[model samples]
Target: MTGITDFTVKGADGGSVSLADYAGQVLLIVNTASKCGFTPQYAGLEALHRDYAERGFAVLAFPCNQFGAQEPGDAAEIASFCSLTYDVTFPVFARVDVNGGSADPLFDRLKADAPGVLGTKAIKWNFTKFLVDRAGHTVARHAPTTKPEDLRAEIEALL
Candidate 1:
């Protein structure tokens, strides 16, 4: 019975925020890394957030260090890097393990709801994205190689 709105994520400032706060909004949840090869995807993500946020869409980023230690920085450093490097305005939560035993519960639910290629649920790498509809059901899963901008049509369709 668990859905996206039933989950809560740690805010960048260390407080807990329920996904329900984003109720009625389409969500694009991403596992992000500061120094990864896909780091530049932040710009595209930010663009999406800017373009559709007012129209009931949002981009929620969760920094993950589980891959090659690409995101070794603490919350402050990660926030600074995201702001300075990509001018990101969307929510970027505290670092989380997107895979393995220590994975965040929200991500666990995301993967379970929208399994990736061949029904595999574990996120293969950072930048992996899950699209959720307004009612909090995960609709699709995108691989790390999928660019943020490339999902515009899907997002628009949901809108």
Candidate 2:
């Protein structure tokens, strides 16, 4: 059984980072898009990071342009938009595909760990979230429509 620690992802700066780096911390991994209707969820995600970061929880954002081209920006542009618009201080990774053969390996592992909507692993839209426990085991899958604030209680329980 592969855990999240087995995968590596690109950081916003174009550097490679292993999921192992975040091992032992509760993680909220999300595929995001700047121009989507759910873009406002950035506020809720940032709030969660601020609320629980000191207690070993982190929100990892991965910008994906696969959905309606809602995230067309490069790494710098995406990072700036997140920081300036929502004051998002959590880590935001480089843009990547959330579906199809070109999808990032990190996402492939996440989908395999927790399928959604009738065991389908394909990501349907932007902002789909995967919650992982401190041990790197994926615990829950939240659809794009599931607001970040709604996961607070669950995150708290994990923390």
TM-score for each predicted model, relative to the true structure: 0.98, 0.97
* Model 1: residue 95 alpha-carbon error in angstroms: 0.6
Clashing pairs in 1: none
Write candidate 1's Cα lDDT for 1-159 as tens digits.
Answer: 967988889999999999899999999999999999999999999999999999999999999998899999999999999999999999999899987899899988888888988989889999999999999999999999999999999999999
> What overall lDDT, based on C-alpha atoms, would model 2 receive against the true structure?
0.94
Relative to the true structure, candidate 1 has a C-alpha RMSD (angstroms) of: 0.7
The regions of model 1 sitting more than 4 angstroms off are none
Per residue, candidate 2 scores C-alpha lDDT tens digits across 1-159 of 777877888989999989888888999999999999999999999999999999999999999999899999999999999999999999999999988999898898899989999999999999999999999999999999999999999999999
Report every candidate's CA lDDT.
0.94, 0.94
Indicate the TM-score of model 1. Answer: 0.98
**Residue 123 lDDT in model 1?**
90
